[model samples]
Target: MSKQPIYLAFSTQKGGAGKTALTVLVASYLHYVKGYDVAVIDCDYPQHSIAEMRDRDLKLALEDDHYKRMAYEQFTRLDKKAYPVIESSTEKAIDDADRITEQADFDIVFFDLPGTVNNPSVIKALTNMDYIFAPISADRLVLESTLRYMVVINDVIKKTGVTTIKGTYMVWNMVDGREKSELYGVYEQVIAELGFEVVKTFIPNSLRFRRELTETHKGVFRSTLFPPERSQLKGSNIDALADEILELIKLNGNG
Candidate 1:
């Protein structure tokens, strides 16, 4: 059996790295696909992107005929309710998440944090995570920022000794397969030397990333109803990445 109420965060010190997107992707898979009880805490106080996405997903689940039917078909056999969406102050999101896990029958709690470490509140929130999975790109600035962010928080953990953070791992996001970049090779080397383990499953940059909810948005969630083989072609390697993450968590005894 899997562990109960594992708290995870998808964060980075740099913005526009698909933090919100991946949070919802894995949340959707865990709840709708793998049939686990899940909750999401949108801690981006200003943006509330995760909260908006959750509302969008709920609307689709309630209003779209085909989507509602698919959701019911998947959820009918389970005892869990529809996933909950929470909006919290950046300063209190971690404590709020702990309360949610303690009070709810959730298997996991996913936190969507803002893309900066300048705030003292955010640093405290980072120490609350049982695991932190950051999305990284080929950009030098982003790589540097994320590495620094990890080291800073790890130091906090060492100093405070008040966290379940086994370690932080980076996921390769927004890769363009048609063209190979020398920058990525260099980034990989530096990331390895920095002791950051980049996962093997890399997500390709795709149009499906932008589309959402309605027929027009064309977001990747629409494809979740498709068969597994078809969803694989839709350019979100999220499920594969989720599997790798689950294995790592279990092996680390955080599961």
Candidate 2:
């Protein structure tokens, strides 16, 4: 039987839309909670953000005894062996992905794509993915770029006949709930008109995210790390968001 792997691509034609952050969160969640043997392909050449984060996490893990123990425990529970993120692009990255799927025995592969649509390598990477998650902010430029990315991917799907595009998801990241922003409403309407599925969960603009990056810990987002000064995202909200994403994968049965 062929091993079916979940291929998720975090993509957009705009930078600074929390692509890398979302990628890390998803992979970390899968590795720690879902117990998936995950591999990451850092296809964002010239600036491999995913690779950097992984390296940082590794270094932190090595220095911190508690983190090391946690990582070791997670690996022991995984059905498949652990593999590090592969950093490559162009012909080489494509070749590596094929090899990794065949040999490494991963259950899922996350591709951290660059924020530009024109790169041939990026298009090739997208063609291989089961789903594309496009993170969008309330900024006009980012919204325009996200739409452009969707169009580009749609074109590629039509051309390559890769039916795994599934659909595009617009996640509201770095949102502030206290303030009402007109740009948020405008972007939502635009996305609705464009026929994209907007994810209901909004990742609040919190310092916890930055702390996660520095601490290099997994599942911090899963728990309420602090009170008052660091308000945790509602448990129901996180659970619903996770369920929606998982349901997308289950419904398609492609990822």
Tens digits of per-residue lDDT for model 2, 213-255: 2354434452111111113434313334555777777732333
Backbone clashes, each candidate: 5, 0
Candidate 1: how large is its RMSD? 3.4
Q: Write one digit per residue (lDDT tens) for candidate 1, span 21-102.
A: 7887777776766666778898897879867766777777778886687668766666456677789977889778777777
lDDT of each: 0.74, 0.65
Q: After superposition, how far is residue 250 of candidate 1 from its true place, in Å?
A: 0.4
For residue 166, model 1's alpha carbon misses the true position, in angstroms, by: 0.9
TM-score of 1: 0.85
Prediction 2 TM-score vs. true: 0.80
Q: Please provide TM-scores, in order, for all candidate models, with all chains considered together.
A: 0.85, 0.80
